[model samples]
Target: MTLPWETLTGEPRTVELYLTTPAGLALSRSMFNSAVWKPAIRATGIPDDRHNGMHVLRHTYASVLLDAGESIKALSAYLGHADPGFTLRTYTHLLPASEDRTRRAIDKALSEDQAGDDVPPSLDGLDTA
Candidate 1:
């Protein structure tokens, strides 16, 4: 779907097309390579020898989704991967520090239990000791 800011005359742009020049002409691969991508890389001051491509953007998107608590299966589907296992294998390192967060949560719960008055309702009948 065309975003409100993407149209000049307020008419929705076609969904099938992604890249277009300022004049509304479809941006060709050659135009993107020479006119857009190269200039962006040069502006960043990254060495020409370093890895640079549209795939880097895809990786960033996957990492952001994983860090935001999106399930691996859902990310896999969004990324068009055939298997969730592939997504897990590719993005395991990018996942958030859930182990640290879990530890902190448990510590808080135990401290609240010790305080007596703040014990969670779910742990009320359990032997917290």
Candidate 2:
């Protein structure tokens, strides 16, 4: 579909807008690179390379959300992945270590039976003396 555009030399042109702004406005490729993306990448102090493009941002997006404890099913839908299993496979390394999950699970289960600051009840079969 043809979209409106302006040339660097002030000529009006017809073109397709590729990247869009967060506010939903269509941005031509040049406009997006000059006005938005280039500045953001420069701010990060990393030299711009052909390999460091929008897909890098997408990967970082997934990494940050996974680190924040977002569920695979929810992240999958947010990322428009067809299957949650794919999301898990792609981002499993970003999840917290199993030890963290185990600790949280024990803490949560015990806290529900007490005021959270109380000492956990000792398992009857374990002797700690």
Candidate 3:
């Protein structure tokens, strides 16, 4: 469940926490107040007043997934959502672009398909005049 640091960053660092330092006793709080989080918050233009750890990252991840055409059901599963409806409601705004893209793709596919070209018009015998 742990990611290999070497894969993302070549910097050598240990993941283990020893209780010797104040940070080691409460890792979440320490990390939330750390320099890394502070800089990341500034860089991302996110308010630093949020103290709920890196939950903004979770929101961003969900938004990104939804933006990438991932279905709400799939995103719910990936995020361990308690209910698919919750995921849908929470990420509704993030889905419109993806939905539009999908709609366009389907329309494009249908337009390019030659299979329907041979079908005679159903109203051919009906004259509007």
Q: Candidate 1's error at 63, in angstroms?
A: 1.9
RMSD of candidate 3 to true structure, Å:
10.6
lDDT winner between candidates 1 and 2: 1
* C-alpha RMSD of each candidate structure in angstroms: 6.6, 11.5, 10.6
Q: Put down candidate 1 lDDT per residue, 1-129, tens digits, no spaces.
A: 454443366756546566888887778877887788878888998754436765677799999998888999999999989899999999998998888989998887677668875554574533644
Candidate 2: pairs in clash: none
lDDT of each: 0.79, 0.74, 0.69
Stretches off by above 4 angstroms in model 1 are 1-18, 21-35, 117-120, 123-129
- Our tally of clashes for model 2 stands at 0
What is the TM-score (0 to 1) of candidate 3? 0.50
Order of candidates by lDDT, top first? 1, 2, 3
Q: Which has the better TM-score: candidate 1, or candidate 3?
A: 1
**Candidate 3: pairs in clash:** none
Q: What ranking emerges by TM-score with the best candidate at the front?
A: 1, 2, 3
